[model samples]
Target: MAETAKPAPAPEASAGPVSAAGAYLAAGVASSEADYAAAVEWYGRALSGDPANPALLQGALMAHVGTGDMVGAAKLAQAFQAAGGKSQIATVVLIAGDAKRQDYAAILKEQAAGGSAGAVLDDLVKAWAKLGLGRMSEATEAFDKMAKTKGLEAFGLYHKALALASAGDYEGAENILSGKAGGSFPLTRRGLIATVEILSQLERNPEAVALIDRNFQPGTDLEIDDLRRRLDAGEPLPFTIVRNAGDGIGEVFYSMANAVKGDADASFTLLHARAAAYLRPDNTEAILLVAGLLEQQRQHVLATAAYATVSPSDPNFHAAEIGRANATFAAGHPEAALEILQALARTHGDILAVQLALADGMRREKRYDEAFKAYDAAIKMVPNPGPGHWVLFYSRGVVSDALRHYDAAEADFRRAMALNPNQPELLNYLGYSLVDQGRKLDEALGLIKRAVLMQPDSGAILDSLGWAYYRLERYRDAVLPMEQASQRMPVDATVTDHLGDVYWAVGRKREAEYQWRRALSYDPDEKLAARLRLKLAKGLDAVLAAEGAAPLKPVAAAAAQP
Candidate 1:
């Protein structure tokens, strides 16, 4: 899910030279807001006034890198180092610059001189540098050393397999990737793709197909499906996971970014992802990773720019466009975002993910008719609908309900339940709808109880369960769950209103009126608001009598029933 952009933190005014202080403060504010273009501008101004300031140099370098200007960042890095400054980011940028130039010796010299870019990254870069220098034995030895280190075995083994495949030692790479040479380790999407390519080189297309099938499902992942289709056609895939030493170094940075993503600061991960893209601009995976991290940080404009860099011909182009739509939406341009998805749906309509994304966007925008059509197109693309396709049915059901096609909505919801019987959201939605219509009271209560069992902490599900009991006239049974639901969702207008209704049925008239006031303060729909006001003025019984509805049974009377 894309985060809505938040206000940028205010930068403290620096107590420095007056001109430099203003520039520094402006740059800091821009950077905090992820306005890298403005940050680069302000930091450049700050650097011009304070040429030798280490902090200014570092900030400028980061801003340039964030904009994907590796050439500019390299120049600032050199100036930073010339000023007696030391930084891990500088080391990473310099190493990437050297790799781009194919100057492996410089990278080795930097490492030998104790230029560190994190322990794991430095070690991986050293191994790749050795490979670039044609010192195969040293490279293998360095990779072995990394594998022997605790907590880094997976990365080391995975890269060693890639290096072996790049060197045309397919059998050796297969041994490592197949877990015959080393213990089992998880493979990332890139790692798995590399393995499939290696298998194809060895004329093991069947095994590659099986590998793809085992890891991915049909109509789910377009990239995986494309690879599988080509492999099944007996196409010989060339090993290109790492085309050269530069790509190997890029992979090292990309791997580190993947490793530290959720554990490290977003900016820290961005540094690694940027370095990866700088080293290998053709690496769509790295570009997507950079865009995703920026989106996570609510830098929607920057993320959209990053996503735009993925070429349309790339297999992951659909994925990039989806991400771009999300960033665009989060940037507060819903119309533009919807257009992007609409265009993607036209071009890649056969791809399941694209259609689903378009449908979801339509649903979010409350275009129920268009959403229903998009969902139908997506569902038709599935070869045989299975349990994993429950979301498609459920989403279409939601649109159906919104469009007042209750029969179609019920059918779709039942279809979703048949596909995924225990899905709590589907259960709660269907059960609550049944209760609201005063139909299937017993079955509605049972379905809601099941949903509550699965998601005890979900305020919506609890509300549904309580509402089911209240509709069945079990007022006392409804009280505890409704109160619990209100507590869980303290400010939800509907839950508070339901709690008020339950309280009134149980003869807690004063508390009932208080809860109705709270619900009104929470801003319910106009229809519910008018009803709540009537109940407040004339009391629950008077309002029910005016509407010719059955009055709430007393708690004692409800409990006295069988």
Candidate 2:
């Protein structure tokens, strides 16, 4: 046998001032938990006593930036750099500060001193700084050089197009944006909008309108619709995608944030996104990115605050409100979330997303009647429902089921299945519902079997399959799946209860009682817990007899093997 290892000794308690060691420890704990605000406060207290401690300064600096407190971070950056700290993040903060003041010479000086925000970003910033200094030829040359760099053609060409448009070279901008200069490059929503504006500036409003139509469906995006309407009316839209080099610099950070979103650490991505938003307050996309990242970090209050920053008159206001509602809900303010959606519905009822969100909020609150009506209103918005609309029907079916409108619920479920035949949740729900009601046993079994084949690891679906077998009096057939489901969802009250029932049906009386106790420990609902206690006290036979339920049919001894 292998020798057992002894536990490591814990650190001895510190005798230093609380502001020195204790504050530093607290900051580190908060930072590790991503509680940046608390970390910043603790770091401040620690730094008060230790001032130039490199680790304390670095921790404080990162905590400030993590909360998008650039002003505080800049001050910490100064202290950090003064004490010989060399951090890339400090360099970025100083660079952003210079960029904010439109001090192009300062930015160039920083770059000359070997300060960099990585290779690609450094090159992009150099080009934008050149443009800021009015060195048009130098900026264009730098952009062209970046375009020729293999695998980075899109970044250079896209920015070059924006620069040309800002300089009133509509033809040159159009050539690059329309992919006539070299080869086609991918365009983001902002890039597409820039191209549309450039086309309109060149007196090609018809082409701009057609481009908008090709990229965005009518009635889908309010901003796109507004653009299309203006273009159709023969309006010459101004090229405001990048009005100056400052906005261009902001775009660089925004682009970096988007690129690193899923691949990098969320805090790292948030730095870029927050920097972008700081440099250009009007960059709604950057703000949204910050809010979304905060939500992912479970900083729900911060996310809600960021979402609330979007102006009501802005085209993205609806999107922001929706995000705010979700963040509010996540922050344990479900009623506030419902209120936000309800207001959104009053203002933008024609929008499918708004209606769907409102319906979902009602459904979550168990306001089934209101939820069903809201879903009805949402379904009416889709003239011709397709596969993407499957969720709408599914949600309506769920609400209908809750309201005891079984026939309507079944019809809606069928419609949802027709739209997306292989959706495992839909299969499981319909099958489980049928099995629970003791109807359509064979069809229910087939549906659940198909669902299990698709999602074998789903504890809920496995539980449904096991319960179906129990209902069919196949005690032996029910055992394996019930045991597997119980293992997968060890703390699930319903699954534990089902496992207990299966055990009792198979004559494992002691195991049945053990599972029932476990189910009670997992906090089953009052009714479920009551029944479980009754079964444990009086046994399954008398309990089933009292409830007038069918008694378990005896199985063959060989078939009863656990």
Give the per-residue lDDT of model 1 (tens digit) for 116-168.
89888988898999999999899989899889889989988998988898899
lDDT of 2 by residue, 1-562 (tens): 2443321111223355464677877888777766777778888888888899888988888888878788889789879878888677877777677788899888899789777788888899999999999998999999999999998899899989888888899999999989999779989998999999999999999999889988998878899999999998888999888888888888889988998898999988988888888888888999999999989887788899889988888888899999999999998899999999999999988888889888998998898888999999999988899998899999999998888888899899999999999999999999988898888988998999999999999999999999988887888899999999998999998999899999998889899999999999987879999999999999999999998987777877435543
Give the Cα-based TM-score of candidate 1 against the true structure: 0.89
Candidate models: Cα lDDT each:
0.89, 0.87
Which pairs of residues collide in model 1?
none
Which consecutive 10 residues in model 2 have the weakest lDDT in total? 5-14
Q: How accurate locally is residue 518 in candidate 1, as Cα lDDT from 0 to 100?
A: 94
Q: How big is the positional error of residue 388 in model 2, measured in Å on the Cα after superposition? A: 1.5
**Per-residue lDDT for 207 in model 1?**
99
